[model samples]
Every structure is written in structure tokens, then in C-alpha cells.
Target chain A: MSWYEQYRSRYARLKQAGKPFFPYAVFKDMVVVSLILAALCWLAYFAGAGLEDLADPTDSTYNPRPEWYFLFLFQALKFFPGRLEPVAAVVVPGVSVLLLLLVPLLDRGPLRHPLDRPFWTGLGLASLAAFGHLTWSGYHSPLINPTVEKDPLISRGIRLYREMRCAYCHKINKKGGNIGPELDRSAGSGSEEWLAKHLRDPQSVTPNSAMPKLNLLDDEIQALVAYMKSLGEPFTAEAPKLFTQNCASCHRIGETGGEAGHDLSLIGSARDKAFIKRYIGDPSKTNPDSSMPGFKGQLTEVQIEDLSRYLAGLGR
Target chain B: MIAWVHERTGLDRVWKALFERHVPEARGPAAWLYTLGSASLFVFLVQALTGALLAMSYAPTPDHAYDSVRYITGQVALGGFIRGLHHWGASFMVVLAVLHMLRVYFMGAYKYPREITWMTGVCLLLLVMGFSFTGDLLPWDQKAYWATAVGTNIAGQTPVIGGVVSRVLKGGSEMGAATLTRFYAFHVLVLPALLAMVVLVHLFLVVWHGISELPERRLQDGDPQGP
Candidate 1:
């Protein structure tokens, strides 16, 4: 008899000597499924799924992440840039599925044990390893364009800024009217206290200032100050190269550079330009435990401004 | 009553064939590993039940989808709980399905008479992923909208059929009301039907072939002796 026939006979003998499926197998299945059901209920009750804001098609800064199972594919797409994205997006997954479908046909040996089937076993383990590594990398990778709206106070400040129509008087990002000083340039220079004071009573801070005290509430003044502080000056191309030279040795941005410090890709969401600038000037002033060296006297004021602006614009 | 029903309907024979059949013994850890497939089926059933409950309160249109989901989450009794079950059930299904597939692959259980079972199982796995993709858009939240946008754009990156697939998925050049309705239909109507059919075939093949006995070290390197 052929090996296939021998195997079939052997399997038939094994089946004849085997246990009945109903009580033996069914009992185990019930036990495990009951455990799973209990766990599902526990998770459903405590860790309910979340929903974000309503779909905002106009919000260009929103960063999207796929479900966790697809994160490996999402991360894989980053490696193949430009026209080759199709390879990562389509051909890779298609070929994987095709290979998966063809596995039984390709490995037609009678060896059923993993040790006996080295090649297939090794391939399976390697695929599993790759999947795990890609998912880990994807989970750690920074958001593509982290929106400031992730911060509730900052988002509230944004709404207040829009509602107050501050753009009517001050130019921001060179888009608003030129009736007042450009907010991006002027705003970053003021401390939070100074900005709040100015928002409350402009004449008290600057006697000849044309800005009027709009009779705002304390919370409104705080929000406007926060909005003003968030406005950052535009930086030159030299800013990134400066970051590469000065900070990349100790800091990381996205998938590139070093990792000695906290990742700065989402730093802008946490810290405004003024705070970043102060920290950069003297790390000890803002963070007493910081091991980073001060760069106040080392870099020129213009270069520092450019660098801080570039960093502040990150993830926003 | 049982005999009367069995006499007319012949249900006893079917029950004997399905439940009273013999299965090759698997002891120790191997026995536990055998439960993954059944566990996956259990999770799928959970998903179907919870998904149906969610559908009762959900609206598929772009205009009402977000509000309806919000209302369900915030106001409806046990709505959040059911939605959570469905949400976690999707992840559990993916995890269990993958684990089951991996178990089958490692055990070389797909060889010989079980190839069709493995093939049907792969189709079921793909159907589960389709369910996830389509169900994601039902909430109409920012995460859902933008993720779907990126997902469709990626689909549109296929070499030749890219544009067509993307357009069909979106139901237009852009993701809008049409896309939401299309995804809702697939999530609720099409993918579930496909999943149920594929799952039936896989389970049928399993029963028809019988579960492959755990390969023994004695048979690791040599051919089995003929009966």
C-alpha cells in the first residue's frame, strides 16, 4: 500500500480505539467557552469601548490609526514609499494569503511533527515573529500628525479663539488681517502671566497699546492666553538641520534620530513654544531633574527661536 | 417525547453521527490546544448576538450615524455594555482565529484529507477581517472616518484593480454617506452571511474527516504500518 493508504488505515485504527466525542470533548469545550464568556462579560462591563468626536472631515491634523490587528500592515506600508506602496499594500498581503492557501500543497510530506517538519515549522515561527515585531513597532511609532485637540484645555482654547474672533485684529500664520502685530511673532515672547494680564487689562501692561480690554472672564482670559502662547513663528529650513545637529543625538522624532530623551514627535501637544524655549535655554529652570545641558549661550538667539518654533510645530 | 421526535424526524441518527462519533485521544497540553477552534466559534456567536443588539440602535447614514451611536452609548440601557461586548468580541475573534490557524499549521493538521477544511477556515478568517473593516465605520466617529479613509486609500493603491476596488468600497471618489451605507450593509448583511456559510463548511469538513490524532514521536520520521 502507498504511504497515504497506510496512513489512512493507521488513522482508522486510532479512531476505533479513541474516546467518544460527546462527553469527553464536549465537556472540555464547555468549560473553556464558559471561561471565555465570563472574561468577555468582565471586559465589557469594566473596559467599555470609547468613541471619539464626530467625524470632522475638515480637520486635516487628525491622526488615524487602524485597529490593533492591522497595525503590522500599517507599519509595513511605511517601508515602501512612493509608487512601491502598492507592493506593501496589495502584493505582500495577496502573496501571503496565496502562500497560506498553498501550504498543504507545497509541504506534502507525511511528517506531521514540528521537529520532523523543520522547514514548515521554521517558516511558521518566523512569520509569527515578524508579525509580533511589526505590531510592536507600529504601536510605538508616533502619530503622523498629532492634533492639539487631543488636549482638552488646548482644544477649548482653540474654540474660544475662534469664537472671540481674535483674528480680526491680529495676524496669525500670516493669514489674519494686518491690523495688529502678528500674533505668532509677538505671542511667543510673552510669559503666560504677562499674556493673561494683557488680555485682562491691556492699558495696565502697555499705556499706549491700542488693544482694548474686552471685559473677559478669568477663564476666558486664561484660554486666550493659552491660544496666544500656542501660536508659533514659522521656521526656516535650517531648523531641522539644526535639530539634527543639536538634539538628534539625544532626542527622537518619529521613527528617525536618537532615543536618549523622550520622543519629541508629540511634544508640541504637551509643551508650548515658550516652555520649550525656556527649557532649551536652561533645562534646570523648568525641570530640576533634567540631565540635558543648557544651550542658552552656545546657540545664537535667532537659531534658538527657529529651533524652538520648529519643535513647537511638531505634532500639531 | 425524545423517541417520538426521533422516530418521525430521524434526529437521533443525526445526533449520533455528529455527537456520538469517536475522536482520537489528545492528552495534556495537546488536549487544551484542541479547544481553540470551538472557542473561536463561541466568540463568533457572541459577536453575532451583540452586533444584532447594536444594530437595533445604530443608524447607518452619515448624518444620523454619529448621533445615534452617541445616543446609544450615553442614553440607551445596556447599550454601551452590548457595544462593548461586540467591540471586544471582534478582537477576541481575530485572536482566537489566528491562534486556531497557528495551531492547525503547527500540528500539520491541514495535510492530506484536511486541506479543504484549512481552506474554508482561511476564507472564514478573511470574512472576519471584512466584518471588522466594515463594522468600524458604523460609529461615524473621527477615528472611524479617517481610518476608513486611509484604509480605502490603501486599497486604492493596488496595481491595476486599485482604483476600482477603492471606488467600489467608497461607493464614490470620496468617503461620504454612500460609503457608510455600503459598509453598514456589508457589516450587517453580506459578511455575516458569508461567515456563517464558510464556518458551516469548515465545521462540516472537520466532522467528515474526523480530527487528526496528535502525531506521535514513533511516527515522526517513519511511515505508518498498514492495518
Candidate 2:
């Protein structure tokens, strides 16, 4: 008899002597399904899913990360830059999937034991290891935009700013009414104590000021101060010259400059002013492997702020 | 009454075939490993239930989607819990599906008569990912917006048909109202039907071929010795 025929007959005999599926296999399935559902319920109750702010396409500083399972693919795409990015994005995954679909045909041997099919077994383990490593790397990668929404104080302050109709009187980023000074220009430059005092009683700092007393609690005052402080002051035109003098050697913005480092033309899209400021002060603090030297001591604080504000406004 | 129904429909015979049919015993850890497929099925059911509940409260539009999600999470009774289940269930489904595939692969259970089963399973895995990708856009939050934007842009990287593929996914040149409504239809209407059909085929094949008996190390050759 042919080996296929022999194998089929042997399998038939094995089934003939096997136990019924109803009580045995079904029981095991029930136990597992129950356990999984219980755990899922626990997670759903204790750790509910969170929602971020409304979708704002104009908020280019928002960093985009895929769900965790897809992170490995996202990380894998980083290896291929520019033109070849499509290969990592498409071709490699396409080939791997095609190969997976053809696995039965590829390893047609009748050996059912993994030990007997050492090559296939090893290949499976290697794939799993690669997947695990890629996922770990993706998880550990530094986020270009450390989320502004993560800070409750800033979020609350923003909410309060809207509730108090601060925009009705004070201009900010050139959007609010022109009755009061632009907060982006002057409000952020004040010391924490001064800003807090101003929020609590507006006329104290600037005599004959038209602003009214907000009558906010201390915590509310603190929150507004933090929010204002987080805003970037306007950068000087000299900011572009500073970049050309120092950053253009390695970084590329728009059409000109070297490409030793990443293209910073769209840097504003993923990173906000605060992040750029910190990253400029000390690259190692945020990204240890960064080859760029820190400009903390080399440049003055005002220069760094100006540079960050300049970079932060780029792409947006 | 049960007997009369059984006689009229041959229900007992069908039940016996489906539930009482014999399976070759899988020993110890292998027996536990067999539960992964059923576990995945359970998670799928959870997703379906929670997804349906979410749909009741959800408005699939750019203007209302985010607000609707917030309402469901904050106001609707037990809404947060249900949404949480759906969110976590997606991850659970992916993990369980991969683990089950690994079990089948390592056991060489996809051989011969079960090759069709394996192929259908691959389709189901891809379908699960489809479900995830489509379901993500339903929230219409910042993460949903930016992630989907990046994801479609990646699809646009395909060699020749890339632009067309991404446009179809986004439902236009840009991600907007059309994208949200398109994703909603796929997530709620299209993928579930495809997944259900594929799953039925997979289950049918599993029963038809009989779960391949645990491979014996000693029977490396085509030997017919009983364990």
C-alpha cells in the first residue's frame, strides 16, 4: 500500500479507539473559555480604555503610534529609509505571508514530530524570536512628541482658560481678542509667582490694567500659571541664522543643509515647543544615542528658547 | 416534544456527529493546548457583543464620533466596561490567534488533509487584523486620526497601485467624513460576515479531518504502532 493510504488507515484506527469529544474536549474548552472571559471582565472593570482629545488634523505635534501588536511592523519599517521604505512596508510582509500560506506544501514530509522536522521547528522559533525582539524595540523607542495631554495640570488649565473666556479679552497665538496683551508673547515670560498673582488678581502687576480679577482658587491659579509657562515665547528672526550657523552642518531643513542627521523640515509636526527646548538643551537627556552635542552651556537660555520656538513652528 | 422534534429533524444524529463524535485523546499539556482555538472563538464573541453595544451609542461621523464615544464611556450605564472589553478583546483575539497558529504549526497538524484548514486560518488571522484596523478609526480621537493617517500612508507606499489602494481605504484623497463612515461600514458590516464564513469553514475542516493526533516521537517514520 502507498504511504498515504497506510497513514490514512492508521489514523482511522486511532479515531475508532478515541474518546468522545462532547464531555472531554468540550469540558477543557469550557474551562479555558471561562478563565479567559473572567480575566477579560476583570481588566475591563479595573483598567478601562482611555480616550484622547478630539481629532485635530492641524495639531501636527501629535505623535502617532500604532496599537502594540502592530508595533513590530512599525519598528521594522524604520530599518529601510526613503525609497526602500516601501519594501519594508509592503514586500517583506507580503512574502512572509505568502510563505506562511505555502507552509504545508513547502514542508511536505510526513514527519509530525517537531524533533523529526528540526529545520521547520528551528525556523518557527527564529520567527517568534524576531517578532518578540522587534516588538520590544518598538516599545522602547523614544517618542518624539511626549504627549501634552498627559499632563493633567495643563489640560485643566486649558479647560479653565476656555471656561473663563480668557480668549474674549486676551490674545494668544494671535487668535484671541486684542484687548489684552498676547499671552504667547508676555504671559509666558513672567515668573511663576508673578503669573500666579496676575491670575488671582490681574491689576496688581500692571497698574491701570483692564483685566478683571478671576477670583480663582490657588490650585486654579497654579494650573493657569503652568499652562502659560508651557507656551513658547516668540522666536527672533536670528533663530534661522543660529540654525544655519550650528545645526545646518548636520541637520537639513527645507531644501538646504547636510543630511548626516534627520531632516528637520517637518520636526514641528511631531514635536512641540517644550520637547524641542529640552532636546536642544541636552540631547542625551531625551535620546542617549544622539550624536548631537548639548547646547545648554554653549548657547544662552534665550538663544535656545528662540531656536526651539523657531523649530517648533516649522511644518505647522 | 423534544423526541418529536428530534425525529422530525434528525437533530440527535446531527448533535452526536458534532458534539459526541470521538476525538483521539491529546495527553496532558497538549490537551490544554487544544483549547486555544476555542478561547479565540470566545474572544471573538466578546468583541461582537461589545461592538454591537458600542454601535448602539456610536455615531460614525467626524462631528459626532468623538462625542459619542465620550458619552458611551462617561454616561451610558456600564458603557466604559463594555468599551474596555472590546478594546482589550481585540488584543486578546490577536494574541490567541497567533498562539493557536503556533500550536498547529509546531504539532504539524496542518499537514495533508488539514492544509485547507491552515489556509482558511491564515485568512482568519488576516481578517482579525482587518477588524483591528477598521475598528480603530471608529473612535475618531487623536490617536485614531493620526494612526489611521500613518497606516493609510504606508499602504500608499505600494509600488504601482499604492495610491489607489490608499484612496480606497481613506474613501477620498484625505482622511475625513468619508474615511470614518467607510471604516464604520467595514468594521460593522463587511468584516464580521467574512470572518464568520471563514470561521465556519475552519471549524468544519477541524471536525472533518479530526484534530491530528499528537505526534509520537517514536513514530517518526510512517509506522502504525499504537501509543
Most lDDT-accurate candidate: 2
Two-chain DockQ for model 2: 0.69
Error of 2 at B65 (Å): 1.4
Stretches > 4 Å off in candidate 2: A145-150, A156-316, B218-227
Q: Tens digits of per-residue lDDT for model 1 on A25-74?
A: 99999999999999998998899888887787766667899999999999
Across B44-91, the per-residue lDDT of candidate 2 in tens digits comes to 999999999999999999978988999999999999999999999999
DockQ-based class of model 1: medium
Least accurate 10 contiguous residues by lDDT in model 1 chain A: A146-155
The lDDT of model 2 is: 0.88
Per-residue error for A162 in candidate 1, Å, reads 12
Poorest stretch of ten by lDDT in candidate 2 chain A: A143-152
